[model samples]
Target: MDLDVFVAAHQAEWARLEQLLGRGRRLTGAEADELVALYQRTATHLSLVQSSTPDPMLTGRLTQLVARARATVTGTRRSGWRDAARFFTSGFPAAVYLTRRWWIPTALISTAVGVLVGWWIATHPEIQNAIGAPEDLKAMTKPGGGYETYYSSHPAASFAAQVWTNNAQAAAICLVLGGFLGLPVLYILWQNMLNLGVGIGLMSSADRLDVFLGLILPHGLLELTAVFVAAGTGLRLGWTVIDPGHRTRRVALAEQGRAALGMAIGLAAVLFLSGLIEGFVTPSGLPTWARITIGVAAEAAFLLYVYVLGGRAARAGDVGDVERADQTATLPTAA
Candidate 1:
């Protein structure tokens, strides 16, 4: 194929398309019709030139022109609060529900690790002693000690904000950093479980396991679930790198990565609720059963939301990704 001859043939049409696009206002009816025709032809031209010729500069220019023309023909869409409503009601939960296989096991294994560490420390006086002097340990585990006071140390509003920020950041990190093959996600899970184990070990050794449970159960249930969801979504994304199933690695990663990002936003809202419980309910005067009941109810509600609403959404084809039109168009590949 003669590249110069082809370029000459299309140059006028390309120039006209560019002028129409650059007009920066609504196109006349005839111009709109012309732009649509040009866009379709240019896209075909791009595919042909890509296959037959290897002119990077010309291809790049046509690629950009085709993109701009396509957008103009399709009409740009601007999202509003309705999109956010749909996301929260459908996209977010569907994403989380879809990844339940990953997060459920994550929650179970991580909890077991926490329990094992606690049991080891609680049974081994030497380890407990190594952690702190006997006197300091007693002071910390006493009736109104550090574990109990920590929740109420700050004003409630500020404390809730702080907890929300910290937990949300942790969840965001898990989702974002999971792209690196999940090593960082494992490390994060370990650190969190380690802390939980330390508290359990110390409290059980002090014969105040009930106190620790009372302090933790109110907020810990939901708070930990959000973290687990984020971690699982991230791990799922990392797994795409190793096994992308039917799709190309790039396509699989893009799909899962977008879902994980959406889950991050959803998890942030979940963490905020947990933060409220941690700040206000955990340390409040509610009886242990009452506080724990509230936490249990919240957790149950969240689970139901995922299964019922999310299942429906997924069945309806919402995969927690951007609308199809919003996604970048991929050129057809030979099978």
Candidate 2:
């Protein structure tokens, strides 16, 4: 292939792209259409030259031209509020709904493990002794004890912030490290459930289980669900890397990774709500049933959002990835 011939052939198109880019702020319909077409073609040309040519100056020049053309064609993006609105109304829920098969089962299995462990700890005094001294256990499970007092230990605002930060970090880890064969996600989930089980067991053994549930259920429902979503999505990502079906592994990973990242952001908001509930509603003087009802309502609302809004978007072909125009892609080296 003659680089000189290739450059000569495309020089005219590149010049046209530059001309359109240099035009006035608003474009005519025809000019707008032409700009898009030229941008795509120029991008492809850049790709080809980068792979096939040895001229650094030529490559650099094309790169600059393409970058400028992209800015002119796309213009500035919508505001942050618009992005947030779109995420909750469409992207976040769609991603959650899409991964329902993975996370729903995860919720069930995790709950089961927690229940089983709680039962084991409740019924086995020897196990309770192994966990802590009888007096220490008594101190924790007695009325107005460690379990009940912990929520009120700090100022509500500070506690809410702390919980939000901690939960968000946990969710981030689950989503980000999912590609490590999902083992880390599993470990994190297991450790979480184990702690819950031990807490339930010790509290139940002392007949303070009701108090624990009253406090926990108000925030745990949504908090746990968000965690489960993160873990399940992470596991799915790992599985995709292991078996990407018809798509190339890289493509599959890219798709799922983007979805997982969207979930991470979405879950941050969800966790924030749970943190509010934990710091305010959970420790409030409200009746136990009322607190639990608030938690249940929040959980139900999230589920409805996923099933209705998310399911609709997904069924209509949204995969929760960043908009295609915004997505970065590596040009195939052979293309």
Candidate 3:
């Protein structure tokens, strides 16, 4: 059959099927059977039409039909409860995928580099001197000396502003670099890890490791973990473009981009909160045990939400499932 004729036939059938579906009434067995047969035929025709010469008008019409069909299947409006539940559920799968698939590996690799380089630099007094002379080393080695002194001198507003600006810049770098094939993203990750290692090494040298831990661990755990998550998202996004894995590049990019964006947004929010904590709470002379306890508890809460709460939420209203239908029915519809 001619391509135009084939598309026309399918388009007519697709429109009719859409109308039937849109009626929003239960279909009789015969009507449902007929609709299913028509759907299958239309799908076959669409495949053929796609492979043949493309018509802009037909393609547009088909796109519209498909979008309408999707809306009908997914529902036109979502409740706030459903939205919150979905956000929670979607987060864990992304976190799990990131941790096992990318974050943990990247962190391990980066940490290894940081430890090796940091250890060498710490042990070699000459290199340390080059980075900062022996006289000035006190400032470098001490936690509440250089940057901390600057921070302490600044007004509360200025300090808060600096923290927010710095953290936002870091998050933006992680997100934007993901589009550049992940090399830039990896570089950002490495730089962060390197800085952290050097900071710890310097503190160890000054015999103020406990002070550093009390100051940074309070918020560093959340802040650093969020960065790792952001970097993982970027890595996955870059990999999707480079290696599409059985799907077309465009399709894979779309799918991976959605997942990556979700993770990136979640991480950004986390980093923002971490920055607030670091700026306001960390600088205070909180006890080491208190800092450790807060850090551990914060991590525990995050883990529970991601692994348990999030998982349950995602499965809560899965499309086409009985649970979803029951939940939807319980929601009050507009009169």
Q: What is the C-alpha lDDT of each candidate?
A: 0.91, 0.91, 0.64
Report the Cα lDDT for residue 93, model 3: 48
Give a tens-digit lDDT track for model 1, residues 1-335: 79999999999999998999999788889998999999989888898897789699999999999889877887788889999999999999999888999999999999999999999999999999999999999889998888889999999989999999999999999999998998899999999999999999999988999999989998999999999999998898888889978776777888888888889889999999999999899989999999999999999999999999999999999889988888765556445
Clash-forming residue pairs, model 1: none
Which scores greater on lDDT, model 2 or model 3?
Answer: 2
lDDT of 2 at 166: 96
In model 3, the clashing pairs are none
lDDT digits (tens) for residues 131-246 of candidate 2: 99999999999988899999999999999999999999999999999999999999999999999999999999988888899989999999999999999999999899899877
Better of 1 and 3 by lDDT: 1
Worst 10 residues of 3 by lDDT: 324-333
Best by lDDT: 1
Candidate 3 per-residue C-alpha lDDT over 215-308 given as tens digits, one digit per residue, 9 for 90 to 100: 7777777777677767776787788778977766765666566556556556666666676667666665667688667777776666676656
TM-score-wise, the better of 1 and 3 is 1
Cα TM-score per model:
0.92, 0.84, 0.72
Cα error, residue 119 of model 2, in Å, equals 1.7
Better of 2 and 3 by TM-score: 2
- What residue runs in model 2 are displaced by over 4 Å at the alpha carbon? 1-38, 46-65, 329-335
